[model samples]
Target chain A: MNKTGKKIFINGNEAIAEAAIIAGCRFYAGYPITPQNQIPEYMSWRMPEAGGVFIQAESELAAINMVFGASLTGTRAMTSSSSPGISLKQEGISYMAGCELPGVIVNMQRGGPGLGNIQGSQADYFQATKGGGHGDYRMPVLAPSTIPEAIEHVMTAFDLADMYRTPVMLLSDGILGQMMEAVEFPVYKSKKKLPEKDWILDGAKNRKPRSVFSLMMQNPTILEKHNYKLAEKYKKMETEVIHETYLAEDAEILVCAYGIMGRICRGAIDMARKEGVKAGLFRPVTVWPFASEVVSKLGKKAKKVLVVELNLGQMVEDIRLAVEDNKKISFFGKPGGAVATKEEIFAKIKELIK
Target chain B: MKAVYTKPISLTETANSYCPGCGHGLVHRLVAEVIDELGVRERTIGIAPVGCAVFAYDYFNFDVTEAPHGRPPAVATAIKRCLPDRIVFTYQGDGDLASIGTNEIIHAANRGENITVIFINNAVYGMTGGQMAPTTLEGMKTTTTTKGRDVKVAGHPLRVSELLSSIEGAVYIERVTVIDPANVIKAKKAIKKAFQNQIDKKGFSFVEVLSPCPINWGLKPLDALKFIKEKMMEYFKLGVIKDSTNSKESK
Candidate 1:
């Protein structure tokens, strides 16, 4: 039994798996993919111990579909994969979104576009925040900068998914997935407090039979109405935007990033501050319902805003959209799994201040 | 006032969208009847496929969820795994089962998923207007195969029942048709047994019903039945392909 605030040395992938188990995830289906394979490996043994079900699906497609099925039963279901595998799962994810089935999908992203590399990259930022699947849909994406934060984010993702009756994503990366860190696991939450899933299909029983589907071909009007309803839900979800600002209250240079890049920027900003440069970090934890208001407000106060990422300027586009003033924002990116070092980022901040 | 020919309570009052003379309605009735007979209607969950039976959730008066195109088996596998005590089944068409969803079905059977599969093999892509299915008969004419399905190009019609029976995890596999009253009875029996095997905790029961598609086959309703008897049945034999239920009956 995991006690409250039990600290342990754990890898990111295993931490995520254990965190999900603590979050009341009773069913998990996943296919083996790089960087995220430890998640399934850990789940295979731990799930059985927790009296949960674990399936090594034939493909990422099957794994996601299995999660979809499990989700319909009102079980806390999840699936994790790297970039390529996550691409294959988009079909089922789209279906789940259309059906309003709630589940958590973890994308321990590696280099992408197509089987790019087994190294950490934030190239999937656009894919994760935008509708990766084919639909007018948005999923809440939580990007954790550290292992301990990843645990809390995983729990938050499940709660958000169930609260909104929608799919939520815990967006991690290969570096975070492979690294080990000291983490304090929160106590397992009892499922009793979770919102009742009155719409779930555990057989009709005494109630009227229910159907879950996305095919509105029979009536286009029905689909149109559903689309507008989803838009309203997304508008409501925009309020859940979360972010963190480090020493930005009095800074001329605001370095904006997320996930591992956020942690790196914090280090770089500190290095600049030590050397008499007014630099700070702005990290959006929920990248989808982005902390645009905070970024917009902070960007106005700062003389220059620099966006850094593992990919070639993905989230920078969102920052640009948020900060609006094209002249005030700049981007420094390392494409194709190459990570930015603290010195490299500090140099960019120094140049921006000058 | 004997209740002899009353509609099965498991079926809803929704008017089926299936074409006149289509076997789906009959098979639906049979499945509903089996659920009623087994007294599992309250605990039965159906996974509907994306083809003609996409609206099965509306027809079946029990909880039903739609699976993506050709993914009913995979969906059913998860549902059964999550709720072991609840009866779970998937209804899929020839194109959905034999073509796109082959991987899911094969693996589900191999894993011995305790669920039932009702495979309606109409031998052509009926919903999409008479396209060539993997189970489309050799030299058969359809919209995609205007020159008749070339076995050299399109491959032979898949014998799903025979293929699934070869797997050790599959406890029961049968192929039956609903061309006439006798064959319809046999198909019903096969479907019932498939559900019963699931109820008895036997693993991976499958029943492949060789059905008729009058509109897709470009034949009259009566002629479509004749076509099944004369052409379809000869290619896909009617019998229990495998039965390990009795060999290891322990529910």
Candidate 2:
């Protein structure tokens, strides 16, 4: 059913699929994996009714490739998977990057290194922001703290992908993917003109046949030139979409986090403020072009910086890089698949303040 | 007199990256000639596989996407479905199609995707330094099979043509070789038929060519040709395996 202009209770995974459909994503191919299967489950039924195509591919590798194929033809395409399956998708993702095809990929992350527990964990933070695949390419990575925000990111991820002509990842963890929340289609579908997808391979028509590929292997000169061009594209993205701040103004202690941890930290900041301690929050909306400027500016008054996350502080390094020697940095984390409660974060804030 | 036989309009003027005596160049020429003859160059998209022929896009002057090893069929399936009015095909090697990507090929064929598949079977992994491929002949020596492929340990070479022909969606299946001029014509004819099937909106069509790699096969160009004629052909027999769209055959 097309749930446009309707509010319904949906999980994070289903929210993402509905957003993709509203965003004009008519093609989806994915193999089922833990914590992210609801996305494929939802799209399998929704896509056909929406006059689109859906394929339950044989493997994650094949699914990503199918997405590549659909995207190559200038169709809005997408795929979703979990940690292990995302690892398998790296090859096809790299190829798609090399070819510069625009598409959306959702990673409802779970614990990893290999078939780790299915519980929600933010363990793939490094893999999502840093290059999960090979090469010097970066995709715009969106992390949503709630099901509604995940829906918003899905709606925009496709536009960002086509805007930059690159893949955009809607990165969430199992917690957000599994939890149910009331979500509304935030924005009405737009009638904006998309950039000329003149490079798509739909039978060159009257124009010269254009080849979309990433193999500059035969000539170092061409390959080097291509890399430089991609670097310039990435540089243009640094100013695109950055972060969100909560009560960041005039605070002595600033906490930096993202996704579920950021949501938890927001609750803790309220608790700490009620206890007469000055605390603020910096949440990075995009992991690649991280909110470095916001962190640097927000940490100007705070005497101490606290970084909270799951899986042994993966995002702390980004925070450290942003604030560098200007403030004392403290860290807290759970190993994997363990959620940090609001009370635990508030206690950490109290100890750091003390 | 100047020659009238210049390169086909579909072939680019750039030099091909294929090594000397590699059968890929002939196959590329055959595909290009077929596209020119069919007057479908404007609407045809070719998928280059991951192997020595990975650089096939440089030679073919058409829209081409480079697929990961053994994944061209699945990629082609999506492209053809999204743009069914356009002509799409995948050119893949033996190790690419028969081994790592075997499942994708089977499923795409089973689904009856309206696309063309050009499979090149040379029995050894050419660019990867003569590795023992899934189609490596029994008792054949390769880098991984230094002692020659022992059937007791290594599995038998795949008869992909015979195997894929059994699938219901595969409308046409043939195996041809390009060791000689006469055989080259036959290979071109098979490729032409495969493309024609897609043009007719028939289901999946496949043609496997017994190509040769002189450098990897440890033979001179002529000897490579002779090897395909004598040794490779004996194991991978050349013929039509299926034609479901033929007037003689029922659905």
Candidate 3:
């Protein structure tokens, strides 16, 4: 166990890979894609040393399916890619969701409508939060604002995946994936024992035969029953939604943001506070199963709410749903590789507060 | 006391959904029999592909995972890697393996993934109506290739067993047909040998079963079998294309 708590300069992608290793990830299959290539590179070297398996699959489609296979065998598995690659992974992601397989998927989002840019972008908000894959399934999505949060979120992702028996996506942008920051590695504790493999198809040697399948057979009634089970699991996950509020109490204006955009919004909020505006910021850590109830509580005290995001008003829709028709909610955003800077967000906050 | 020959242990009691005379039912029974004879019914993991065999997970009493379209190779690769001691195999159709999933199968075999692939080459895509598949014969007509697969437009039919056998990583590659009782026996032997090669950890093993899709072929069950034997076998010869059992690498 690396108990020595030493501060090390690391990027968000590296932090996520190291944390995944600490969380007992024994299988990683991924392809090289911009902004998130560091993740696959790190895993390729680290997995071998940890006595884990690493495969550079032919494509994102193959990579994610490989993770699905490894996860089926009771191993902690993961894959990472940018937006286009993530799109390619959607089919496998849906399969993983259907099979209730546990694994981690990292999406270092770049601008996209079709291979948009290599720069930072949050255009995948709708795809990630609303379930990009086919079918009526939702993966728990985590948005990290800082390098440390990226590490912590990934560790939490593995636990949540195992707990719910579902895939979890860590949605970050190119900026977060590329920027370096001082981070302290989490204390590593080896699990006392590996989880029991009774459900896995390791081998039926001494036990009753086991099977892992997602098909409910073309029977509508059986499919409905299966879907009902999935819905029940999702309803239970509502309690796990997380968010953070800064000076939201006694504020007349509230700013809703997440991921890197949320971090920039904080700066805008600080600028507003110096200008005598009673403004606060609310950042959601878990985007899916959106922290609606938390935001609604904060909305009760605020006169108005403003959402700042990289995409053209994606998260704003969620914010609007959170506040309902009780308060006026406005959005400020830029799409296709344009990031919402502090100046732009501050300008929006000024207009909302005035 | 009277002795009875029951269905293979690996197969469930549920009746098969395959059309009467469909080779899938016969091949399934043969595979189940192999699993029973080898005493590996309990230690096997079958990956069912997206096609007519998508419901294969239900037919096999052992552990199974239904892979997405053309992704059975990738699924089987991962399963075998994670559980090397377990018998892992993928059952896929022409569209699943030769078309959408070509890269996955090729790469897995290139890496010498110790898994068996039961490639069902029925000439045309059976699940989604009579569409021309990667293995659809030249000059053969189907919904997608209504003008009879022109060699200039559609190119030649893919000989997967012969193609895979050329790869150094593949240890066993054979093409067989389930047309008659004798050929069915040979096909079963080929399937069992592919599984046995994996058990021996020789390398990647593939057995392409030339099957019949009667409805898609616009023929009766008997006519389809005859077409597979006389017509399809001319393009996809039935024999062992490659076998590493004689290679010094095995020793």
**Cα lDDT for residue B166, candidate 2:** 83
lDDT of 2 by residue, B87-193 (tens): 89999999899999999999999988889999999999998899999999999899999989998899899999899988988999999999888899999999999
> Can you tell me which runs of candidate 2 are displaced by over 4 Å?
A1-5, A188-194, B1-6, B247-251
Q: Model 3: per-residue lDDT, tens digit, A192-222?
A: 3334545776656666556677777777999
Of candidates 2 and 1, the better by lDDT:
1
Ranked by DockQ, the better of candidates 1 and 3 is 1
CAPRI class of candidate 1 = high
Q: Which stretches of candidate 3 lie above 4 Å from their native place?
A: A1-4, A188-198, B1-6, B248-251
Cα distance off (Å), candidate 2, residue A247? 1.3
Better of 2 and 3 by lDDT: 2
Q: Each prediction's DockQ? A: 0.90, 0.78, 0.64
- The models' CA-based lDDT, in order, is 0.92, 0.88, 0.87
Per-residue lDDT tens digits for candidate 1, residues A186-273, read: 8866433557899999988879999999989867899999999999989988988889999998878999999999999999988998
Model 2, residue pairs in steric clash? none
- Which sequence of candidate numbers ranks them by DockQ, best first? 1, 2, 3
lDDT of 3 by residue, B51-155 (tens): 888888678888888788888888887787777788999999999999999999999988889898999999888878889998999888899899899878888
Candidates in order, TM-scores: namely 0.98, 0.94, 0.94
lDDT score for residue A126 of model 2: 87
